[model samples]
Target: MKVGVVDVGSNTVRLLVASVGSGEVRSLEEGRAHLGLGEEILLHGRIRRRKLDELDAVVTEFARIARKHRVRELETVVTAPGRQGGESERLLEVLRRATDGPVRVVSAENEGRLAYTGAVARTSVGPGVVAVCDVGGGSTEIVVGTALLGPAWVRSVDIGSLRLTASLLHGNPPTRTEVESARASIREAFSGIAPPAPELALATGGSARAIARIVGGAYDAE
Candidate 1:
């Protein structure tokens, strides 16, 4: 089987396609375009025409690629800022017009689970309880439990880098006030629900990787 992963995010629209279990098909067909989808919606409380135009163009290009590959089945999923009801409806319509295969809008909860699964799969599995954190463009999924993530204990926070950056930080490198304020915001949201602090574990997103990259010494070598 052939599979594709599409993340119609607030800041970017991304797609990756690969043939299942085929070592020969090592490189997945991938594409990316910045729509800055969150710039207005999550940042300014509404969507703007210019951004939608930019998004339309990106989805069109991705759809064209999927059709060209003659993919048996294509799965496109959206997250975070894309979860807004009416907002999602409008963006999804554009995606349908762009792709040849099936495109489904995944819920925020499910998106979190997928992320948790993806994170866990990359690590040593089934030893004991493992916590997974998925910090995204508009949401953060923190899965704290013993037997993988199930509903009850899994919680998601609607504060992500884009939201924090847009709302709190305005300077190029971020002001000290913004840093402390956002940290305070995180601590506030994390109140009461004391998740097991993440172990020295895999930090999966760019925000994490960037920190690693910036820290440089031990992390950058790998």
Candidate 2:
């Protein structure tokens, strides 16, 4: 069956159109756009018209691609953007019009679990009490479970790279102060985090992979 997944985040919007089933899945189309939905909302409590326009474009494009792929069912998932109030309704209305489809306002915890299931289906790491972290432009989710996939606990924090970058870091490499501040905030959120008695942690996010690539690149350039 053809399935489409759209994640409307704080900094960007993304679409994943794929064909799935029978233990096999392939992405037929994907799209992304920078909308900055959480910029002013983090500071204030609303989204600006400029950012709304950006989101419209992203949603329109995603709609086109999904139609082009002839997807049967499209499932769009939205996180904190809808619950933030202050301006969530307006933004959601705009996006719904852009696609003329249902937009699901998923709780942070549920979003975390779904995303983990999707990603882990692609790659399940070493056997143990697996702790999964999926971070986006607006929130970070941590799920702890056993090798048998029994539930342990799930947590969601409102801190993403863009959120940190805007509120704290403003440089490409981010200053020491910014990094330290960001770390402090993340620690506060994960203060109770114990990793479900796991041996190691599994981190999944653009920030993690990008940092890894850049570090490797720097070493190779030497």
Candidate 3:
């Protein structure tokens, strides 16, 4: 089946059109638009009208692209913005209007599970613990579990590159103090959570992939 998966995230709206079958999947198309919904919500405690309008436009475009690819099913998954207080309904409405498909808000735990599942599926491993880390705009999800069974533990921390950048880094290039402040804030946020040890650590999301590419000269799931 050809499915179009729409991710309505805090910093960006992304689309993935893929063909899934018995034991394999093929990517047909992928695209993303920076919406910055998290920045507004974190600062003002609600999604502003301007951001909503921008999101509507972007989602409409993504829907057009999905249609162009002739996907059999369209599903929109809303993350952090949809979990925000007093803002989920408005965000869901915008996505539904734009995609004309089923839109659902996934809780932080579900998000962690989804991330971990996707990451683990890409690995060539057996019945061993695999740790998956998904660093998004609004939150960072860490999941550890057996590859064949499922996640045994999931922790969603409220610290991410975009959130920290928006909240702490004010200058064009942040100063040393600003960098330290962001690091300390992230450390404090992760202080409460402890995840299980894993045989393999898989990093998902944009920042992790970029870092892997730069540091390792390539991206590797292992």
Candidate 4:
């Protein structure tokens, strides 16, 4: 069967059209739109009308692409923005109208588990304690588990690239003071959570992918 999955995240809206059957999945099409909903929410405590309108257009386009691919089923999942106090109902209504499908607002725990599963499935990690880190616009989820058993421990921190950038990095180039401040804030946020030592660490999500491209090589825990 062909499935279309849409992720309405804090920083971007992403679409994936894939063929799934017999425990195999093949990507048919993918698309992304940077809506920066997290920035808007952080600034105004809710997604503004303008950003919502933009998200509607992007989701519509994704639906069109899915239809073009003749997908049999469509699913939309929303993250941080949905968890945050915001105009999520209005935003979800717009997404539902665009995709003509059920739109689910998943919790942080679900997000962490999903991300961990996806990452471990794609990597070459063997049975052992494998840590998966999914850094999004509004939160960072760290999950530790054995490859054979799945996630045993999951922690979600309310600090991410976009959130940190909005809160501390005001300058265009981000002065040294601003950088230190952001680092300190992130350190404080991670101080309480302790993840088990892992045989391998896998990074997932937009920010990690971007870093991989810049680094120009396979991702390594080192």
Candidate 5:
């Protein structure tokens, strides 16, 4: 079936159209609008009415794009914003009106699972243990498993780049002290859990891609 999926993330609203069949999904088209909902959430502890209206408009346009592509089904999924923001029902109502299809907030576990499967599906990773990390705007999801067995462990850390920046890094080019404070916050967020070692570790997210452009697409302890 040809399906259109709308991802409502804290940093942006994205649309992905694809053909799903025979255990594969082929991308047809993609689009996104950066709304920076995380910053609002950090400031107000909830999504304001104005932002909700903006979200509705974006989703409506995305739905139109999906129809233009002749998709059989269009579904919307909310990520960190839905989990962290207050008055989630108001958000859901707005999305349901805009897309006129399925709309729901994705659970943290499922978010990790989808991130793992989506990343691993596009890579040439072997059937050994693999780990995938998605650093979203309001949270980060980590999944560990093999491509064959699927995710065995999933965890979501409730701190991401946007939140950290809005909460700690006030300067445009954050000062050294601010950078260190952000690093310390990140460390504290992940201090509780230890993930199993994997044969390969994959990072896939907006921040990851942006950093890859500057750091040559690879990461290591520096």
Candidate 6:
């Protein structure tokens, strides 16, 4: 069966179409739009009418693309853009108009679980606990679990690179003070949180990819 999923996120709206059978899934098509909903939320506390209209258009296009690809079922899910913003009804209504389907704002725990599942599915990991970290535009999710048992621990930290950059890093290349301030904020956000140690750790999302590119192959205490 071919299924489509549209993700309404803080920084980007994405669509993924896949064929699933025999306990395996194969990607057919993927699409993304950098809508920067998080920046709008930070600026105005909610998605404004103009941006909502743009979102509606984007979702409508994505739905059309899915149908063109012969997707049988399509689901739309919203992340921090819907959860952290105000006037959710407005957002939902716009999305429903586009996809003509129910749009759900998934909880943080559900988000973490999904990230964990997707990350571990593509990697080779042992039976021991694995951790998946997803850094979105408005939040960061940490999920720890084994591949067999699924997520055992899930945490959502309400600070991401977009929020951090918008709030603190002002310069193109942030000044020393701004960098320190960003570090301080990150430490504070992660303070008092202790997750179970994992034998393997995987990261997902745009910010993580950008960091990986800058740092080379893998990240560590080095």
lDDT of 3: 0.87
Q: lDDT for every model?
A: 0.68, 0.76, 0.87, 0.90, 0.92, 0.92
Per-residue error (Å), model 1, residue 113 = 1.1
Q: Write the per-residue lDDT of candidate 4 for residues 1-222, one digit (tens) a residue.
A: 999999988888999999999988999999998888888999999888888889889999999999899999999999999888476899889989999998999899999999998888877887789999999999999999987999999999988889999999999999999999998998999997889999888888878989988996465546
For candidate 4, the per-residue lDDT at 68 reads 98
lDDT of 4 at 20: 97
CA RMSD for every model? 3.7, 3.7, 2.4, 1.5, 1.3, 1.1
lDDT of 2 by residue, 134-202 (tens): 777778888876545744678888878777778888778988888898889888877876655655455
lDDT of 6 by residue, 1-222 (tens): 999999999899999999999999999999999999998999899999999989989999999999998888999999998888989889999998899877899999899999999889888899999999999999999999999999999999999988999999999899999999999999999999999998888999998889889987476755
Q: How close is candidate 1 to the true structure, as a TM-score?
A: 0.84
lDDT of 2 at 202: 58
Q: Which ten residues in a row have the lowest lDDT in candidate 6?
A: 213-222
Off by over 4 Å in 3: 217-222
Please provide, for model 3 over 118-178, each residue's C-alpha lDDT reduced to its tens digit, 9 standing for 90 to 100: 8888877778788889999889999999876899899898777788999999988999999
Cand. 5 Cα-lDDT: 0.92
Candidate 3, residue 140: how far the Cα is off, in Å: 0.6
**Model 1 off-target regions past 4 Å?**
22-26, 145-152, 196-200, 216-222
What candidate 6 gets wrong by more than 4 Å, as runs, is: none
TM-score of each: 0.84, 0.86, 0.92, 0.95, 0.96, 0.96
Q: Please list the residue runs of candidate 5 whose C-alpha ends up more than 4 Å from where it truly belongs after superposition.
A: 219-222
Query: What is the Cα-based lDDT of residue 178 in candidate 3?
Result: 97
Steric overlap count per candidate: 2, 0, 0, 0, 0, 0
